[model samples]
Target chain A: MTTSPQNSADSRLPLVIEKNLDRILDTWISELQVDGGRLLNLIRESELREQASRFLDLLRKAIKVAGVNPEKTAAYDELRDLLDELSRSRSEQGFTPTETATFVFSLKRPLFRELKEAHGDNDTTALLDDIWQATMLLDRLGLNTTEVFINTREAIIQRQQQDLLELSTPVVSLWNGILALPVIGTLDSERTQTVMESLLQKIVATGSDIAIIDITGVPAVDTLVAQHLLKTVTAARLMGAECIISGIRPQIAQTIVHLGVELGNVTTKGTLADAFALALKKKRQKVQDI
Target chain B: MYRIPILRVEEFLLVSIQTDLDDALAVKLQDDLTTAIATHHARGVIIDISGLEIVDSFIGRMLADISTMARIQDCHAIVVGMQPAVAITLVELGLSLSGVQTALHIDQGMRFLRRFLAGRDEEASDERE
Candidate 1:
């Protein structure tokens, strides 16, 4: 059974990795520690070694089954999964993209050394061929690690935005029948929808008839923000609750007027105190001085 | 023909919609409610719709029409117990029901109608003076 030079070179790389797994992992980890010193501090030494060995084992198996194109084969799925987990954990631990990817690319030097040792001095062409193949596979895996890291970071940002949206809109019951929703941030359409739904839900739960939307924490009131405020008010009114927008800074009021935004019949107050007082008045309750 | 029941409570006629209303049933409800208000000489009408989970644009229009019809007959209409989701949908559909009054529940609706009517009576007396 005679194998072509290409087949022999492709098949021999995996054999070299399997034979020198320990030596490769030792060199890879040391290379990573030198380039990714900050990343190493974030994770334990033993855990790092285990991850490196597992990755090398999977890579060898993948190469044996799928040759050079491990990415297009089911044999590489376990390798990809391991990379995904490593990238996610490293990203969460504050590893930079370069640092995360170095975990895979750093394996190149150790692997090329082992491939050279296996090929010896007489087969320089086979040695170069093996080195090129190893380079291509490692580069693909390195890029995949960076991509996973970026995606994980983006997912975290999206979840934080959702949490911030929920946190900013809080509907508190001020009196027996008055609810106060202090609008602290900029009101975009999505935030306004959350605000509207939450305020209306609180109205039903508390049976509050009046809601004061205090925008004192809002930095600026643009036309779009005013429109969002109106939508929220309209939604609240539809649910049988009146909205009193308060905390309107003088500048915001000026901006609203200059923008020709029609707040029209939705009540506005200069301060949260004034709005709360008005809400109490509408409910026919007076706060008397002792 | 199915009819949405209208209950008369003192000076107000209470219409609690417990089922999803189609076009014909909605129109029949409008007709029945207007007739009920005139015959009972009710001062206000309270429409409770908490049981309704979905409302299309047609039903929104019908609600506005019902309030307008009640107003023509010298009666005030307060829509009560609207679900939060329905209210959001209505506003999103650009049907804020501005002409129609709304309350969180039936009891609040009754209180609003009483206060509203009392205010109107005082204004009428003031005008007479």
Candidate 2:
């Protein structure tokens, strides 16, 4: 190991990448294929190679412009964008965070091999210094890739959750003048708004005289949920459609009573059928059970 | 000056709000509706707001005021055809329009008024007996 100027290793890092760009890319792709796992099947071979090539080119350019460390600077903005797109696609394509991070970390081996082969006999100390800088840079980039991957996954989950919330709260017309809204799942403020909007819309469209809100599918009844229900009932009343809350399970009944919640003139029923029957009765319509 | 036209349908007064309501227009609507109720001898009033996409607090308050004024004149005020978005906005704005009675559409509103008036007629006959 021979001592040399510190800046020589940092400066030569980008030069080594620039000189052996094609070879580094080729080696990087092969290395990625070996440990790339299920991500290989998700993305096509040509697309993968193109992505790897672009990343290397961007990496080389960013290093030239931003020096050895390229984190958090305008010089690496394009590189960060590329990584963001790559991680987003990976997330959509079902790649795990570890797998996404591995895509970046896998390039380190080929880069280190190229650096060693290029300057192996020149000076061991400078060669190791170059490898060290490469390791730090790749580690930081790899960590960021994982973060972006996780963020994409979380965003996908949140959107799916919203869709599910919408799907579960549907208002259906049970009769000519009556609407039935069966609420399934926990009642959050956002979901309550959806319920109110849909129920009120159906009432207006159908000119429904009575609305039955069935809470059988709801998991739990808390103060917030009760408040949301009250708000819905009140809104429907204001619209001139009498709202009857039904599907109160034994547990929910106990919960409501235990909480000392005052429903104040709002009618409650033990089952949706009971509420529907009441609605029919209010309309002066009756069904004879055979 | 814009005035929301109030039309008379038989014994009921019909006002279809097809445009947005400003403070002046809404105030005019309140006065015009009550005057029309007396002019037309309308026993029922149906205000159709299906065309309105937004209902701020002021509009909601105007609706409540109309219901109150109609009630004082011995007329049933049935606010009908309120858009779902409007209802949500009204509730979110903490304005329940408690004095106003709502129906899904004109047909329901008419039927509601018919039932109410019929019930009133029965009570009046019973009082005379």
Instruction: Estimate, for each residue in A1-290, the C-alpha lDDT of model 2 and write its tens digit.
Output: 45543464444788889999999999888888899988778888899999999998998888887776765788899998999999988888887888999999999999998888878695787788888888988998999898898889889899998899779988899998899999998899999888888888788777787999999999999999998999999888876789999999999899999999888889999999999989999988998979
Residues B26-116, candidate 1: write the lDDT tens digits.
9899889888987999999999999898999999999999999999999999999999999889888999888999889998888889989
User: TM-score for every candidate vs. truth?
Assistant: 0.89, 0.82
Cα lDDT of model 1 by residue, A196-240, tens digit: 889989999998989999899999989988888898899889888
Whole-model Cα lDDT per candidate?
Answer: 0.89, 0.87
In CAPRI terms, model 1 is classed as high
Steric collisions counted per model:
0, 2
Candidate 2 Cα outliers beyond 4 Å, as residue runs: A1-15, A25-54, A57-82, A92-95, A116-140, A288-290
Interface RMSD of 1: 0.7
Instruction: Kindly give the stretch of ten consecutive residues in candidate 1 chain A with the minimal lDDT sum.
Output: A1-10
Find the candidate with the highest lDDT and give its number: 1
